[model samples]
Target: MTLFRQIYSLLFGLFLVVVMSLAYVQFTETQSFLSKQMESDLNNTSNSLGIMLVPDLEAGDIVGAETLINVIFEGGYYQQVKLTWLVDGKQQVWENDLKIDGVPQWFIDLGFFKTIKRESTITSGWIQLANLEITAHPGFGYHELWRSLTNAIIMISILFLIAIMLARFGLTWILKPLHDIAEHATDIAHRKFGPDMALPKTSELKSVVSAFNSMSHQLKQIFSSLDEEVSELRKKNLVDQVSALPNRQYMMGRLNSWLGEPNNGSLMMAKFDWLEDVHGKYGYQVRDETIRLLSEKMKEQLDEIAPSVIARIAAYEFAFLITSGEQEVCSKYLHTLIRTVNQEISKAGCKPNEQFYIGIAQRTDDMNVSQILAQTDNALQKAIADDKVFHWFESNEKQLYTREQWREHLSSAIKNKNFQFKWQPVYLTERDEIIQRELYCKLEIAGKEIHAGQFMPYVELLSLGSLLDRCLIETIADSGLLDRNHEPVAINLTFHSLSDKKFHEWLNHFLRNHRWAKRIVFDIPEAGVYSDPESCEALCHIIRDNGAHFGIDHFGRQFGSMAYLQTLRPSYVKLDQSFAFYDESEHSSELCRALVNVARGLDIQIIVTGIQEQPQLARFEPLKTNAYMGFIYPPEPVE
Candidate 1:
């Protein structure tokens, strides 16, 4: 039992004992007092009779005494008093024997009797007198004793009832605070922090109440501190510096979790070109800002289609893990996403025009998350080699196009530097100077200028985007064209490139040794930068250490994505062209104006591309666009 119950029971037991003891004491005392009173009355009555009888015997009136005795005996008043006198020196006894004739000897012996003896001196003789013994009838004294006992019993019963009622009332009042404490304790056990302290004014409960309040306050403080730390960590972690998106670690964790599901899905990786040159000219702040903008745009664009997980998986690349059974749905969504991201990139107003190449691979239950990521990586290389904006993982059989066949072809290409590079100039419309150039690569096939869309899918299927990137880097450095003083070249990197420790390490080494490496600008796509912002930030540090600048290509494309821009702090934003070139709609122009104003407030430059006319240029000028390109600046051909 609880403490309250035990106390109540103990108190009740003491009350019962007290009530019963009082009853016993009162009853026993009354009985003894009445018995003594009866004995005293009996002694006094016998003595008074002896005095009256002695005078009559001394007067020697034997006849008179005998007559008196007869009279008293006949009146029944002397039933217990017998008179006897000496007559003629002989003993004579006078007695009334009324019941002797009718009463049985046994009854006479058993019935109540009172006996008394008296002696008197007469002239010439000593006489002895005896009084009859009589039993007192069970009448007045019996009634008095019974009445006293009955009254004592009644009083005791009343006392017992009163005592019980009082005990119950008192216990209830005393235990009220205990009940409250119990309720509060139960609530606390269930994880409810309610009713911190509302103890009664009783002195006994005050200390417990104070202790409870102190403990609760401490618990609340601890939890609050923990929550703050967790929030800070979440914001700080899982971000890339260049793209200002979730880093590779966070992305991989997310991908692994997504693939754990039974449902099959697809991943689309976007790799962009000329990000480094843009970063080198514009700076890291502008590049990261452009990436942040692009991420937001992509998220907005793809909001209606499917739930997507977009993250910066590498320096110049991003990966989208899209949930869909059909590859076409993923493909269509991927295209829309790539298109929107590229469009946003052109509007952000970077110094160098930013471009992207995307690779998509669908997920299967049979494939682990690592395997699927590998496929996206492979696809990214193919997209870069083919010089296409995007490519899908699905491939069809040609002459010798099995899975193994493509892998072999990719192995050979990587070993032989089979990929070729091209440059697209982005002109500064106001200055008429070539401020940035976008790099491209093509595969040689019988002297044909084969587009990236044709055979890039196979390269991606072979998981060689990093190898191709490595080969392209070595080839560009070997070409001797990087020594130009005023012209900085931007080349694309893939998510695979960032993951490839050898590739980044090699680039770092190359930048440290090469005399003209500072002119080489590495531009990462918006998706890549945002997917793993931390990695990009790390990459930025690496490049900065080597005297090369980091730039983000596709400017805007992600969901509610201010998270990246605030952290990475890139050099310039390359405005996505879709918003800039959206037929000059009022909402689109307003958005452009707002973005330019925001970028200007941050002291970052904004570059808009795809400008075909004076009106477009005029529309953008008010928005403080730093530069422009399009049909007005013809694409420079390679010699």
Candidate 2:
């Protein structure tokens, strides 16, 4: 039982006991008073009657004495009245019985009052004439006692109810702090380190809450420290200290893993041909400075073509992995990087002779790491022999359009509303219930459906990310699918859109006006959310206020603290597809488990993405993932 109930019951029992005790005492006192009053009344009546009877008896009028007794008995106050006389040494008696009414037998039997008889000797001139006897009925006393007992019971019952209510309220008020403490403990269990600032008035509970807050703060600091250490260790092992880029080992590992997938990207090798000349002319310091500057420029250029990885593999060679799309698209990005690097070197007052040799090789199903490196090396040798700055190994892929042509195609597609949405069902893993349909935006240009990978990179390059996101939202809302099914649909929004104040205002207005807005979920990338947490949090608040939900996609990839989760409090988190494919190493599994636990603690649901087979799905069962989405449950194509 709850504490309130226990206290109420105890209070109720005590009230009953008090009421009964008061009733017993009052009953006894009323019975005693009635008994004494009855006796006194009877005694006085008998004495007075005897004196009157004596006069009649002395005058030799026995009939007068009998008449007096009969009159008194007929008054109905006494149960019995008698007058006894002596004639020639024989006793003569006159008696009458009065009817008792308006009192129940049970009340009389309850012994509230007992019958009392009083007697007096009648005398005339110092001679005893007759003995007068009177018996009093307790019906009146019984009636009085019964009425008082009933009133006492009724009054006590009301007080009992009032007491019970008061006790219940008092207990609840006293125990409320305990409830807050329990909730704080629950939050801590979920890895939420927010402290409870409540200070209960009760000394014990206040102490307990204080201790709990201290423990949570300490745990937060410890986890933060451990995370920093782990991140530093990862960087030390895989990153090049000088350029702050992934080293050769890390690049090779990433490339080997990417090769196992079907949609691999192109790898470009940039070798500085004038490294020896720079060292000879400008000394080692200039040489190192040039390399650092080149690496920084490469990083800056790669930012435009994100989802790309660059690593300094050798002293003079840096490898670039462009996984955005096909070989043709990768070639365009490579050419952009080469031109940007040459411009930076020239702007830095470096000699025009200080050139870089670029070799590009497209990833193929038949090629391994060694083959890829050999092919790129062969291309580099050819470039060197021909004194060319850039060359592609076994170049055979055809480019559909120039950068300007691709840009125009995308702009026209958006303006003409030539994009279609495909719906992929994200299902609850345990019950196979479809919770939401994730919408993928596709562009149809000249009756050819352009894939996301082919278009998104260019979309980012042209600053059309917010436009695409807006189009997708408007398309989904206008289709009425959310209203028809009364189910939610998730639309992906890039960082640009999330940070766009105008987009946020527009979305807020749209949601407020649309009745089906609650069925729309904005799925933001984890990287985007972390990029500007304040903006993300603000947008999340707007979404929540409109009764819409927000989720994090590509989760568990960021190398930062998850404390932002406490503020954003997303409805769910979709695990990155890489988590499903990577070989389960101890470290990877532990990290995955930690992330899962953290999300679970925050009451956020985990949806594993890219489960292409039963084995992949089975791998996540032990983790108790809430949902799954991937090729295994391919999206239903919408025309």
Candidate 3:
């Protein structure tokens, strides 16, 4: 039993014992007093009667004595009365019995009062003439004792109830401090450390609460220090110590993450032409100094735009990943950056004619990181051949219409709700059972359908990403897919949508009214999660409160620390195709193991995506991935 109940029971038992003892003592006292009062009254009445009857007996009036005895007996106060005379050793006796009414035999038997009887000798002078006897009925005494006992019982019962109420109130009042302490402890476990504002009045409990508050404060400081250390370590591993910029590995991770999302960005590659000559003439020290100066100049020009990644990938080459939204603006910024670097180099004692060759490539929906980098490198080679300052990679063919045309098409599709959703099954690897179906959105255009990659860029560019998310949510809700399949349906949410406050409010209200909210899973890209962790954490709380699940897609591409997982606690993380393809390599395998260990520590599931070939799938067995997705388990078409 709980502490409160145990205390209540003990107090109640003690109250019962006390009341019973008091009632028994009261019963015995009343019985003894009534018995003594009856005996004393009988003795006094007998003595007085004997004196009055002696006159009659001394006058030799036996008849008068008998008359007096009958008169006293007729009063009906005594159970029995007797008068006797002695002459010549013979005795004559006069006796009568008195019965009282309204007293039950059982009550009298239970009361068990002894009858009071008294006798006195009467004579004219010295000799005894007759003996006078008197007896008193115990019915009245028994009735008084019984009444006193019943009253005592009723009074004690009331007191017992009052005492019970007092005990309950007292226990609850005293234990309120304990409840607050427990709640504080629970919040601390969730990493929300703070002192309880409440101060208890009880000395012992107050001391305990004060100690707990102190401990929480110390823990918070320790955790903050640990986070700082971890962040510094991560920086050391992913940053170029010489340039204080992201390293090549970090750049690749960022590029991979960007490619996984439905957005448009640009990449710039700059190569120094004089670095080799400088190294040959002044040794490696002068070359390193020039590189550092160039890195600083790059940061001064591009840092304002907040490029996603800037890295010195080679001794003489630096790459920039900018998400400036427009190709024209990106080109303008790059031209300006090139001019600034040329001036800075000329001022630093380099030849005026010698300049860095630059190559710029606009990211496309269909291009991978390697392909994009190749295009930039190809453009750089052309720049070198023509002796141009910079050259933009030109595409030979077009698979889609121009920007204006896409804008018009996507706008019309969203306005007309002309989109279809296709379900792609993700299965549990161990059981080979469908755990969820990932929903892919397709826009229908003039009897033709285009996938997300073909039109999402324009959708995001127009700031209609949230609108698309809403339409997809409503379509799934109306389709009854959840009701029919009895499994969760995963839908993608863009960074634009997650960061939009209005979208979050609308989603909360929408899910509140939707009956199948619990069966819905919102898949947010890992890039979106780390972009704004505070907002993402708030959104996660909202989603979970509404009975929906949230997870990270394209998880392994981000080379940063997994510390965010400790806060967001996403339900699952889907490994990007890069991890699955490179699973055989030792470096990739160790990274995957680290990710798995961290995720498992937080009870988060790991789902490997892009498991197309048997060899790739076999490599994941040792990692013990929780689920699988991709062409290996192609989705069955829904009628």
Candidate 4:
């Protein structure tokens, strides 16, 4: 039983005992008082009758004696009244059987009432005449005693009910502080060290509440220290000290990963020719401040645009990756960012906007990182040689359809539920066990299975993200995919769905109705979550509220604060694919380990993706990565 219920029962039991004891005492007292009152009336009647009959006995009026006796007996208070002559022992008697009204026979059988009888000698002129005896009817006394007990019982019953209600109300009031303390402890277990609770008025409970608040505050500080330490360690290893942008190692790893994927975004390499000259002329402080300002300017513009990956590869060079497939929008953001960076340079009194060269490269053909970087470098060198502001590497590609066509296609596909999806198992390396399956999806146009790289650009361009995400979840639920597999099926949510109220409501309903909803895990990109942390956190809460789980994808890609991970507290986090294949770099391996350690410390499962080679997979096992998924564990098509 709960403590509240146990205490409530014990208190009510004590109250019941007191009420019963008081009721018994009251009933017994009323009974005794009624018995004494009856005896007094009988004694007074016997004495008065003897004195009045004395005159009749002395005058030889036996008829008068009988008449007086009959008069008193007819009143019904006495059971029997007898008048006897003292000379001849002749007796005159008047009596009636005991009869009680408005009182039950069983009440009379309680046997507490007495048949009170009294007698007195009759005399005239100091001579005895006859004996006058009067017996009181127990019926009258029994009736009155029953009435007293009935009234007392009714009043006692009413008072007892009122006392019970008051006890329950007071108990609940006293235990409210205890309930709050229990809920606060649950939050602490989940790594959410919220605000302290208000202390209670009761001394014992007040001490408990104060202690819990102190413990809560201490836990918050400890978790905060851990989050900050791990975050700082990651930044020290991956971020440039002066620019606050990702360092060369981070940039190369991301570039390699993105190049292997299809139609993600364009990469822009920025060369600061005037920075070296400015550094030689100006002091170290000016050069460092200029770099910091330039990075800050770029970050401001990038935040306005969609999610992106940008880093500083060298003292005079930076790389920016735009993941959106919208070519027009990508071009706009790229040019705007260049303008903003050059403006910050001029504001810092360093260089004019046009003095810097930018080389843009997109995936026009299948090529290695070296070839792509060399081509981008060639474009940069050409721009510097030709004195041009920016240059784009040569490419021959065309958009197959316009906005309306792409929208119609996606809308129809979603409506028809024409989606091709597969589940890739995530292996716990030590046990060679599959904990869950991460979903890989593709759009089926007519009869072809087209990957996200082929159709996702258009989906983003046309703003069909929410519709597509909703349709995917609905189709999976309807197909009974969860029923077929015991392992949880993880689905990725889009940026649009994270902010959609209708989607949240529909997801809640779906989860409530579907029996297999508990096996569904929803995850969103790390950049998308960090871009809108509040909305993403709200979405995570909704998913969890409906018995589903949510996680973060590409976790380490965003070079931002780790505080959100503590508050958001996802079920699991997929480390960005770049972290998996460290390219034999110890610093890369160490950075990956730090990210994994932070996540594990917070009790969030960490899954490292893009583990293709055996060595790559083996390296993460020692770091205690929670799970691994890649070409090594291939996907199984879902029918």
Superposed by TM-score, candidate 4 places the C-alpha of residue 474 at a distance from the truth, in angstroms, of: 2.0
> Distance (Å) between predicted and true CA of 366, model 4?
7.8
lDDT of 1 by residue, 521-606 (tens): 77665767766766777776677788776566546433234335434545567665444434454544554565555455445556
Winning model by lDDT: 4
TM-score of each: 0.44, 0.61, 0.73, 0.83
lDDT of 4 by residue, 356-402 (tens): 89888775445667977887888788888888878888766765557
Candidate with the larger lDDT of 2 and 4: 4
Summarize candidate 3's per-residue lDDT along 1-639 as a digit string, tens digits: 877788789988888888788778878788888889888888878887888887777787777877877777666567777666765444554444333355556676664677678878877677878776677867668668767866786788788778878887898899888777888887677656655547799988888998878877886666565555445644555567767777776677667656754567788888887777778878888777777887787778776654446788877788888853567667767876777777766766677446578888888766888899999999888888888878999976454677788878877777777788777888897986888888887877777768776677777777888888888888767777778878899998877897989988999999888888999999988878877887788888889999999899988555566678767778999987656555255655666676676666556899988777778788889989899887776655554
lDDT of 2 by residue, 1-639 (tens): 866677778878887788788889987898789788888888888877877776678887867766777877766668766555654444554444322456666666666566688877777677777666678866667767778877887888798778877887888889888777777778787767775558889997888888888888887886676555546654665577767787776677566545533344688888875665677888888877877887788888776864677888888788887755666677678777877777766765565534678888876544667888888888888887787887889855455566688789988877766787778889998896899988776777777777665567667767787887777777767877676765588888876887889888988898899888888998888878777888898899999999999999878655567777777889999987767765656655555666777777678999988788999888788788899988788877764
Error of 2 at 170 (Å): 5.8
Candidate 1: minimum summed lDDT over ten consecutive residues — where?
132-141
lDDT of 1 at 126: 42
By TM-score, who's the top model here?
Answer: 4
Per-prediction RMSD in angstroms? Answer: 27.1, 8.2, 6.7, 4.3
For model 4, state the Cα shift of residue 17 in Å.
Answer: 3.2
The per-prediction tally of clashing pairs is 88, 1, 0, 0
**Candidate 3: regions farther than 4 A off:** 15-238, 253-257, 275-307, 343-347, 351-353, 397-412, 556-561, 576-578, 581-585, 634-639
- Cα RMSD (Å) between model 3 and the true structure? 6.7
Q: Give the per-residue Cα lDDT of candidate 2 at 629.
A: 88
